[model samples]
Target: MLVIQIYADNPLRNFNYLIACPSSREALVVDPLDVTRCLAAAKQHGLKITKILNTHEHWDHIDGNEEMRRHTGARLYAHNGAMGVIDHVDVGLYAGDTIAVGQSIKLKVLDTPGHTRSHVCLLANSAVPGLFCGDTLFNAGAGNCHNGGNVDDLYDTFSQQLAKLPDNTKIYPGHDYILTNLKFTLDREPGNRAAEDMLNMLLDHDPHNAYITTMAEERRINSFFRLDSPVIIDKLKSEDPDFSAAPSPRDVFTALRARRNTW
Candidate 1:
C-alpha cells in the first residue's frame, strides 16, 4: 500500500490521506478537506482515486466531499449510521466490511464510535498495518466526548478494540495535536521520561510528519494508554480533592477526559 499524507493548512491542522495500491495506482481519499491539494497530489502521483471515505460526519471532515466526488468521480462512503448526517454516500460500511483498493489492498472497517456515533476507523491489513482513525484516536490523546460522543464508548473502543491491535500498527490520526497532547501527558505524568524525550524530539520534527506513531510508541507517550499509572492518578487526586485513590482504568480515563476538556 502506498500512502500520501497531506497536511491541510487550516486552523484545525487536519491530515488528509491519499492511499493507493502501488501496482494498480488505484487510490482512495480519506477526510479530504482540501480538494485542490488532493487533486494535485493525485496528479503528482499518477493515481486514480476510486473512492472517498469519511471517518465521521463532522462538517470539516466532509466539507470537500461533493467537489472531490465531482472531480474524481469517486464513490463516497461512510458508516451506515452516517447516512442521515452525511450526504451522497454510495456505500454504507459496516464493522467487518473490507474496502478493496485495487487488486491487493483491502482495508477492514472497524466500528469505532466515540468521537461521534457515525465514527468508524479503517485498518489496512498490509504488511505494515495502518489504522486510519479519524477523531477516534490521536497521537498522545483521545477524542473528547463533548460533541455527540460518549466517554464510556470511547473507553470501550480503546480497551476492547484499539488496544488489541498489534503494537507495531501505525497510527494515522486525522489531526495534528501531538504537541499539545504531549504537553498534557507531561502535565499529568511529569515523570514520564519517554514522553519527555519525545516532546524534545518533536520540537524539531515537522507536524506534517507527526502522525506516524505506532501503538508501542503511544504506550510510552500517550496518557490515555497509561491510565493506570500512579503519577496520573496522583495528579488527578491533587487537582480534585475528591478524586479516587484506587481509580479503575476507566475511571482514570473518564477523569482525564474531563480535565482535558478544560485544560
Candidate 2:
C-alpha cells in the first residue's frame, strides 16, 4: 500500500507531503519546509524516510532540507539546474529521471520550469497516482514568473506538459492558495458555473480544508488551463484592449499571468 500524508506548514501555508510504501516502509518527503513536524509525522507512521526530494530551490520548499537530512540521513535529490542555488544535492535529477522507492512506488520527474528555471515535479505512478507540483502549477493558478522565471516557459509547462497528465491525477501544490486562486478565476470569468460552484463549495469549508484538487476539477475551474476558452479570451480582451489583436493562447496566458501578479 502507498501511504501519502500531507501536512500544512507554518509562516506561508506551505504543504509538505510524505509518500511511503508500506511493504518496504521506505518513504520520501516532498518539499519539506518544517523539519520537526515532518519527522514527527514520519515517526507516528513508523516509516523511515530514505530520500528528500525538492521541487524547486525556493526557501519555503527547501528550508528544512539540512535539518531533515541531519535527522534521517536521507539522500537529497534536486534538479541539476539547482546546483548553485541548493546547498547539497546528492543526486541531480533531470527531466526524464525516475526515482524508485521501496518495490513498487516509482516517481517520474518532470522538468517544469516556470516558478524557477530548475523547478521539477514528481509524478507518482502508484495505486493512487498524484502530481507533486511545486510552485510551477497550483490548484487554480500558475506560479509567478518574476524571479528567474519566464512566462513562455510557464506557458509550455502548463499547456504542453502538465495538461497531458491524466484527469484523475491528484495535484499537491506547494501552497494552499486554492480559495484565493478560485476567487480570481471567478472575477475573470463570472459567467463560468464551474468556477462559481467551486467557489461556493470552498466557501462552505475552511480555506485550509480545500487544498487538494484533481486535474479534472482543475480543468473545469482553473482559468490558467482554459486560456483558449471563449469566455476567458473574451474576458482578457475586455480587461486589456491590446489583447484583442488576435492573441494566441500563449498571449492570453501571458496577459492573464501579468494580471494575476497584481491581483
Candidate 3:
C-alpha cells in the first residue's frame, strides 16, 4: 500500500508530502516544509527515510532538506539544475529519471519547469499512476511564477506536460487551497456549471485532508486546465487584445496568479 501524508505550513500555506511503501518500511519525503514535523511523522510511522526528494529549491519547499538529510542520513536528491541552491545533493535527477521507493514504489520524474526552471513532478504508481506534483500543479490551482517563473513556461508545463496525465491519476498537490482556487475560477468564469458544482461541494464539506482531488476533477474546475473553454478564452482576450490567437493554459494561469497576488 502507498501511504501519503500532507502537512501545511507558514507564509505560503504550503502542503508538503511524505510517501511510503508499507512493504519495505522505506519512505521518500517530498518538498518537506517543516523539518520537525517531517521527522516526527517518520518516527511515528516507523519509516526509515531513505530519500529526500526535492521538487524545486524554493525556500519553503527545500528549507527542511538540509536538516532532514542530517536526521535521516538519507541521500539528497534534486534536479540537476538545483546544484547551487541545494547544498549537498547526492542524486541529480532529470526528466527521465526513475527512482525506487521501497520495493514496490517507483517514481518517474517529469521535468516540469514553470514555477522554477528546475522544478520536477514525480509521477508515481506507474502501473496505476498518480502525481506528487509539488508546485507544478495543485488542486484547482498551480504554482506561482515568482522565482524563475514565466507565463510561457507555465503554459507548456501544465498543458503539454501535466494535463496529459490520465484523468484518474490522483493529484497530491503542494497545498490545499481548492476552495480558494475554485472561488477564483468562479470569478473568472461565472457561468461555469462545473466550477459552480465543485464550489458547492467544497462549501458543503470542509475539504479536509480527505478532499484531495483527482486529475479529472481538476480538469473540469481548474481555470488553467480549461484554457480552451470559451469563458476563459474570452477573459484572456479582454485582458490583452494583442495576445496570441490561442494563448496557452499558462497564460490564463499566469494572469490569474497575478490577479490573486494583488488580492
Q: Please, what is the TM-score per model?
A: 0.98, 0.95, 0.90
Q: Pick the candidate with the highest TM-score.
A: 1
User: Which of the predicted structures, 1 or 2, would earn the higher TM-score when compared with the native?
Assistant: 1
In model 2, state the lDDT of residue 111.
95
Tens digit of per-residue lDDT, candidate 1, span 1-263: 99988999889999999989999999999999999999999999999999999999998899999999899899999999999889999999999999999888999999998888779999998899999999999998898787799999999999999988998999999999998999999999997998899889888777666548899989999999898898898888988988876889999999988889999
User: How much is the lDDT of residue 202 in candidate 1?
Assistant: 84
Candidate 2 residue lDDT tens string, 95-172: 889998887689999999888899999998765679999898888888998878999999999988998988889988
Q: In lDDT terms, which candidate is top?
A: 1
For model 1, name the residue pairs that clash: none
> Quick one: RMSD of model 3?
2.3
lDDT of each: 0.91, 0.85, 0.80
Candidates arranged by lDDT, highest first = 1, 2, 3
Off by over 4 Å in 2: 1-5, 204-211
Q: What clash count goes with each model? A: 0, 0, 0
* Cα error, candidate 2, residue 41 (Å): 1.0
Q: How far is candidate 1 from the true structure (C-alpha RMSD, Å)?
A: 1.0
